[model samples]
Target: MRAPARLREDGPLRATLVAIGLAVFGIAATQFTTLPAFLLEPALQGTPTDASIEARTMLLILNFLGFVLAGGIYLSATDRGWSYVDLRMPTRRGWLYVAAGVVGSVVFFVAVSALVQLLSLPTAESQVMDFVGDDQTMVLVMILIVFFFNAPAEEFLFRNVIQKRLYSAFSRMQAVVAASAVFALVHFPVYTAYADSLGATAISLSVVFGGSIIFGYLYAKTDNLVVPTVAHAAFNAFQFGLLYVALEYDIEEAQPAPSHAIDVVLALC
Candidate 1:
């Protein structure tokens, strides 16, 4: 779609490499700073705490930077500036696609979470729920990480850059498949580290990869990154808000579960 947005050899390659390198760095950096804050300071593995809030906030900021850098690289690589495009706003059909993506993602989360619980997968290294039921500021900060930082950055890398690059090199259909695989690779460490059951992990990840394919197609069809970016953002924002409500009301566990759907989506990509 849209001729795969011709690439400038040096322009795209340089940018992509930088983005990937930075993301790798972010992972290392995140662990070094985050582990101690989460584990040593308060050590609240099951419940939300002030220390956990600080630790997660710090790590989230780092994670946000990683996504921003990568997204910047990806956008530059395609010569698609950061400016938003209003060309053909979401048609009814486009809205349908977005809706499907959201529904599928939710199903994936529920199924995966259930599997993780049933299988007794290893718990997340840090206490994710420990951020819930805390100060409103802490909750807001967590929201920023999941919605603002994590979602956009990830979709840009997976859907915008990798998906488009592969699409440039191959047919549209093949590009979708290839991008889906690459997206899945990004989640390897997280998924393996988080999932409780092998079978559930596999099935859930398949759902994730599948979602990537869909998102990739949406980007290709629209030749616009905003569509996928918004889709990604909306999906994440919804989950975060829902989780916040659940935790705030004590209806669901506050900390993020390893089998968390959004996490799976990231892994799927």
Candidate 2:
């Protein structure tokens, strides 16, 4: 009873910790569930090109479920009703934030790509392209996933649940930084594959952290998840759309972004 009471009484700090734990569990869940399903898919049998596409698609779906469950259970235990997280479609002002986020993210992405290139840093191939492997059908499906499910779900879990809870535990700046850092660090496992070496990995991770800070800032500043959510969607849509065009045209000249993905898939973990 005492332990349960503490869990109940604990505020943002406790919620944040629990969110992190559940996130780990969620990632583990992917290992057992999504990974195997993808590997054993009859459609992908003898089609190694489809290996990452099917596997990661399932992984994204499961991760969304896990994040939602984590946030939901935390809300229930903390007695913070659904209203505690503001996810309503933003009014006109919120739209401005969303627009800014999209433009800012694009500007940031371009700037970072140039900086990475100049610095001789490693850049990651677009994971979407890596996975779909000339599979047009999967490409279209992933586009839909990116625009609809992946973007909104990640914002709800990370910004609405995790980052928002952190605010109760620290100053807004501190909380945003902490949340953004955790957001960035969680992606460490991905950098190795995206980067060529430790130095390049660091640079790539910095881009992720920087982008998260922007996302976190928007969430914190606007006092709503709407800004970051839409912004994230737009950003992802831009990238995925670009990738689709590149693939369809077989455009070899376009440089893949040096992305240190934030949301596991950089859209959601």
Best by TM-score: 2
Residues 141-164, model 2: lDDT tens digits = 666675666666667777787777
TM-score, one value per model: 0.63, 0.80
Pairs with steric clashes in candidate 1: 47-130, 48-130, 121-196, 128-255, 128-256, 129-254, 129-255, 129-256, 183-269, 184-269
Candidate 1 lDDT, 74-171, residue by residue in tens = 46665776653223467777777767766766676667567667987544332344344446566566566656666666666666656655544466
lDDT of 2 at 259: 27
Q: Count the backbone clashes (under 3 Å) in each candidate.
A: 10, 1
lDDT of 1 at 172: 64
Please give the TM-score that candidate 2 achieves against the real structure: 0.80
lDDT of 2 at 91: 81
Q: Rate the local accuracy (lDDT) of all candidates.
A: 0.56, 0.66
Candidate 2, residue 98: the lDDT equals 86
Q: Kindly report which residue stretches of model 2 are placed more than 4 angstroms away from their true locations once superposed.
A: 1-19, 29-36, 39-48, 51-59, 124-126, 255-269
- Number of residue pairs clashing in candidate 1, backbone atoms closer than 3 angstroms, sequence gap of 3 or more or interchain: 10
